[model samples]
Target: MKKVINNPENVVNEMVEGFIAAFGNDYKKVHHTNGVVIKNKPNRVAVVTGGGSGHEPLFIGMVGEGLADGAAIGNVFAAPTPNTVLEVTKELDSGQGVLYVYGNYSGDVLNFDMAAELAELEDITTKTVLVNDDVASATKEHAFDRRGIAGDIFAIKIAGAAANDNLTLEEVARITQKAANHTRSIGVALSPSSIPSTGKYTFEIADDEIELGMGIHGEPGVKRTKLQTADELTANMLDYIFDDIELQENDEVCVLVNGLGSTTLMELFIVNRKVVEILNEKGISIYDTDVNSYCTTLEMAGVSITLMKLDDELKNYYDKPAYSPYYFKKGRG
Candidate 1:
């Protein structure tokens, strides 16, 4: 219920404005659009990914040097309009094809598909890779039915690197899908995030409790229990993720500890400490690691851990240099 703003309805607009104001040197707003961000420098295969607005540094903060070339921002926790996606797609097309990558949500899927169809009519080829790495969202038998969450960063990074490598549109999309398939993520929410307009949390949780496997939008979790220690929570999260993707000894993986919104770096590192401890115990090699709030849910107090089991191809792309407003990695250390 507490927010700093002029009008609730104008939050998205002002957010876009503020983003452009600060990052105009690297990003430009699409003319006559609600929420479309285009990179100043074009890529061989334009990478586009977006979703609702509340998840900062996601659909927008990701548009830069080594990430998505463009992003179509949607309303808070809502899908961007088809027209918005179409416009960004069109602007991104520089003879090379465009790749649309976003989370797996009903509204997002529908709108992005529509935009792709519209772009095809103009001879602007487009491909899509829907991210569904939230292992807790579905059983292995229905993995594709799961919702996308922090795993999106892996998708975008691999796709953008492929595109930057001058790979063909189909190649970029293929590798991006491959990276997505190797990824798994799960989260725990200590508190709920509210919609600015409504000034209400989407769901309620007790002050001394947490929801395990909760989705970013306050979706029902596997269980709601009293708050546990950081190590306990991390172990529970890793267990859920490992149930879906087995990490064999000597298998190399990328570990990402993502803060939702209000979760601090100190907390994320604590989670990462446990993640590393568990991985080392299993003999899983850590190739690269990142701990930050690459994606967030509007001040939600939570963290999500993502693991991308890497093959040679995926590791190459994962180690590629990337520079975004919110994400920066100089290859792998």
Candidate 2:
């Protein structure tokens, strides 16, 4: 195993420290905890989302004025401890209450559930909405029960906008779940990623091969085949997404063409162009589009396409203002 690090156990702690050091003014670390909360606590609903590391700009980068109120950091590919989540809840909670939004991963489910229980004992109101938007991960018979992926960004963004509008915790959670249900995602990986601690590729594929339906953690994909051109790849990804969701003409949709990690913006743009062309051919209008690296797999080379079938309400929230380290939007109103 080849990696650059002092110790495997300290990787998470070190990464968290660096993150706080760089963004500490905008955020403050919870004393003796692996959590971060916004420096200025808004009196409206509080949003906290988190999970394992390696997927930076996710639970952490979303912490800002118009996004997550706090984030609980966990080890690479592992969930944060329940106590860590509780600390984050304590820091972000104003009198209004808190909403925990995160991916539908087993470790996250167990730990966040325990944290909610602990927070309730302190009289802190808490609710959770899991993101399960990877249509390629599982079929319709198991959509609600499948794993969450890059589509989580849409959930967090819409929910944060709801909270920014002073929606109740229940309302925020409801809207977040709605976004998750309405959204779907699919990804293809040209390469694998290495966990900092392990110093080995999480999964492997031949040089000319690609993995479809690949998870962020480098889990084995649904299928492996020779690589294709940008247009062909986009079609391969969208075919499953559009077929499964059955979007209709005139449907206003939000599209996210996300780079996993090492993939460049130039490549993403080429892929985005094809995606837009295909969607336009179907007469489906795009309400909003985000083509960037919103989610990642720690230096992995690949991209994921996410589609959110939006309604007027969702489009309104999505158009609202947002500012974060990795994302920014001017208020449309």
Candidate 3:
């Protein structure tokens, strides 16, 4: 396996050290832990989310003034330990309480639950909103039980804004759940990524093949077929998502077309253009649009599209100002 690194075992630690060196002054690392909290003492409801590494600008990238107050880092594709999450919660807790938002993977659910239990011993009230926005994970009949994917960005942004607006913990949790319910995501992978330590691809895909509905961690998707043009790929994904969500004309939505690591910005934009065209033809109004490599699967080459059905309340919170390493917007601008 060809990669740029010192040692496979030390990649996570080294990368994290470099991350701190680049942005540590803007944030503070929790002592003896793989976590970071906002430099400013949190005066409002604290927000925290995390999972395995490899998906940069995810849990950590969202740590800033208007996003998560703290993030617990885990190993590549592995959930953070309960102790690590507990420490982060303790460090970020203000008198107001905290909200935990994370994907619906089993490991995360288990570890965060343990961390929440630990925090309860200290009388630090905590609540969690599981993100299950991957439409490919399940049908509408099982939407609430599906796995989470790129839609997490919207959930974090909305919840963070609520917290920044001085909403109580319960309110933030409610807002986050609402965002999750309104959001849907579907992804296609052209290539697989290698786990640093394993020195092997997490999954295998033929050179001219693509996997639809694949999970971020190389989980099996709905189907595999020969690679199609960008327009065809986008249509296939959007059709599945629209059918699942039952989006209608005159619906206002926020669109996110995200790269899964190795895809080029130009390619993502090409896909986004087609996505916008199709949505417009259907009379769906886009309230806002973001296209970037916000979430990734190591060096996998693919992209996911997320559409969040928006109402006035969701739009208000989404438009609120946010500044994180990965996302930035002026307040009410």
Candidate 4:
């Protein structure tokens, strides 16, 4: 509870109000809900994404050019209410359609599905592509059941780019699903994040310990071990990713080195160095490497590596320029 805030109950509301006030020129608050939509009128299929709060620069900050059109937000580690999602869908749907891209969490799955059904009743075409990229959460036999972690942005980026190209909702969803399937991620948590509402740490680990395959929502990972070197930790993570996706020589990919809150950029770069070296040794072509704290868990000391296996079709959308305050890319379009 060492956070700089007034009341825990008002965290979500106050944070969102502050976000709208700061980014109002390009984004607007969705009426009567903790949601925000881009002010730009839609000329393409709308892309909407959201999940529990606490993962900053994610569902909310991700709404902008080349990203989501709107995002319905929920409280810390909670799902957005069905009504909140519905309002965002209503605002962004410009007769083209709407696509929902979000992490594959049970809460998100339940709420977004309900909202999609509600949208359909009103004749607003809607589709969903659940992001299931956390390789440690499930085995290949249960791949679809894996939890979505830092890899959500890959699916969001691809979905937004396809929608920006004026692809129909169905096409955009198809491409996004492909991206979600091709992407794989694994994380090592050196520590745990705290809950704003409860003012308690989600979980705890010893000072010299790390949890492999930790979920963003603080679910205990597949296994825990004493902390290891940067190279060893990253190599261990990459092994899980490679086993899941089976990357091969000459295969291209987008690498996202995501920080889970308290992990520093310096540390991330060290991890990225090892990642690049391994990729080179394996003959995997790195299409683009983004090392940043894009997806976070509120000062949790951890990092997750995401690799999106790409083909020509996926490359086309992925190479499109994306502009958001948090995630900006100057693609060679």
Candidate 5:
């Protein structure tokens, strides 16, 4: 319940206002909406992604050159209303078309679809690619039903690159779907996060325990057990992710060690250390790696590992440079 804010109900609005003020040079708040579109008008295919707030550097922090062209900001841990999505879609649509990429959550799917339908009334063509990368959410038999998490970063980057390269809307959508399907992730939580409004923990765990395979929004993990060492935890998570994807020796991949919220950089690097070691042992080449709190739940003590299996096409797009508030990368190595 300890949060630095004037009022719980005003957190989303206040935070967004501050964001626009700070990043005004790069983005502008859409009129009458809690969304921001990149200041640089998109001449190519426009890209948009959004979801609930609280996960900083996500839906919002990602709008800029080479990333999301527009983002609909929503309430803490809640989906953006269909109206919000519609407004963002309108702002992002260039003469070419618009592509919507977001997690495969029910609320997002429902609202984004509605927004797309509304955009058609204006003759603005729109398409969507849902990111469902949390391997722990479902078995391979039901992979499409899996929830999205940190792997969103990869999906966004890949799609943005394709769009930046001037790929057609249909081509961008196809490649974006390919990136979404090739990505996989798993997370472990050491402590639950507290919602600012209620000042209540989403869930609880013991002092010496951890929850494996948990979702960013505190969804139940596969199991809760005494905490294991960094190596053990990394192995458990990687094993599950690898089993879900066919990553062979000599294959190349991108690694993302994403902190849920409060986990330290020190801890994330420790996890990354083990991730790289294991990948090397398995003969997978690391193209490049990122470790940071890109997507997060407020004050949640956990981290998620995301691996995007790469082909030449995926690698080319992934290497394309991008600039946003939180995520910035100069093209590939």
Candidate 6:
């Protein structure tokens, strides 16, 4: 329960305020809501994303120049309200349509779909692409039933870039959908993240054990076993990803080695090192590799590896300049 704050109930609000204070020049709040939008939106199709708040640099950090146009923020590990999502849509919707991108969580799906319906009443044409990239969540036959994790960044980046190119909403949505379909991710948790409001860890694991393929909120993983070395663990996680995606030799990919909060860069790089070695051995070319804490559960000690199988079409958009307080993978010069 050791955290710096005024009140537990006010953590989301306070965090939002602090984020604004630090990044107000590029973003602004939707009227009376947790929805955050770029201060000056473009005339192209808008890409909006959202989810629970604890995963900082996620729903919020994804907004910027070549990223999401707006982000509807929910409470910690909670989905954004329909009203909050609608507000963000209202702000981002130009003459062009809007595309909604978010993780494939039940609460998030419910709220975002409601928001889309509400937006439709306002004559804002909208499309949705759910990021269901967590390979360990479901079998390959049930890929669409899986959860979204670090793979969300791939969808956001491709979609945001296509939108910035002033492509039609349909085209942008298509590109985003392609990215979501091509992405696969898997994670292992060494420790659980603490809930800010309750000051309790969301889940528990023995100190000598790790949960393979655990979801960010500590949803049950595929297995729990004694902790292994970084190389072994990385390969174990990748086994699931490779099984999910039929990666072939000479295929190109964008790899994301994401850290869930407390994991250090040093450890993350070690994991990434193993990832590179594996991909190289498989003869799969890497378009780019980003090893960072782009998505996280608060101070959760674990890392998730995401692979976005790329086609030339997807790569064109992915390489576009994007920027926010976080995520400089394809940032502007």
How far residue 158's Cα lies from its native spot in candidate 4, in Å, is 0.7
Instruction: Give the runs in model 2 whose Cα sits over 4 Å from its true position.
Output: 1-5
Q: What is the lDDT of residue 170 in candidate 5?
A: 97
Deviation in Å, model 1, residue 135 alpha carbon: 0.7
Q: Please list the residue runs of candidate 3 whose C-alpha ends up more than 4 Å from where it truly belongs after superposition.
A: none
Q: lDDT scores for all predictions? A: 0.90, 0.88, 0.90, 0.91, 0.90, 0.91
At residue 71, candidate 2 shows an lDDT of 88
Which residue pairs show collisions in model 3?
A: none
Q: Write the per-residue lDDT of candidate 2 for residues 47-91, one digit (tens) a residue.
A: 999999888878788888678888897888789899999999988
Relative to the true structure, candidate 2 reaches a TM of: 0.97
What's model 6's lDDT at 226? 100
Q: Which tens-of-lDDT digit does each residue in 1-333 have in candidate 1? A: 689898999999999999899888777888777555555556488998989899998988888777888899789999999999998888888878999999999999999999999999999999999999998888899998999999999999999889988989999999999989999999989989989899999898889999988999888988899999999999998999888998899999999999999999999999999999999999999998999998799999999999999999998888888887689988863
Location of the lowest summed lDDT over 10 successive residues in candidate 3: 324-333
Better of 1 and 2 by lDDT: 1
Whole-structure CA lDDT of model 6: 0.91
lDDT tens digits by residue: candidate 6, 1-333: 478878889999988898899999888988899999998897889999999998988989999988999999899999999999998998888879999999999999999999989999999999999999998898888887999999999999999999999999999998999999999999889998888788899898998999999999999999999999999999998998888789999999999999999899999999999999999999999989898898899989999999999998998888888888797764432
User: How many clashing pairs per prediction, in order?
Assistant: 0, 0, 0, 0, 0, 0
lDDT of 5 by residue, 171-201 (tens): 9999999999889999999998898899999
Name every residue pair that clashes in candidate 4: none
Superior by lDDT: candidate 4 or candidate 5 = 4
- For residue 269, model 3's alpha carbon misses the true position, in angstroms, by 0.5
Q: Give the number of colliding residue pairs in candidate 5.
A: 0
User: Which pairs, if any, clash in model 1?
Assistant: none
Over the stretch 86-197, how does candidate 4's per-residue lDDT look in tens digits? 9999999999989999999999999999999999999999999999999999899998899988888999999988999988888999999999989999988988888877
Compose the digit string of candidate 3's lDDT tens values, residues 1-333: 589989888887787788789888888778877887888855888999898899998989988877888889898999989998999999989878889988899999999999999999999999999999898988889777799889889999998888988998988999899999999999999999998898989888888999999999999999999999999999999998888787889999999999999999999999999999999999999988999998899899999999999988888899888997788978674
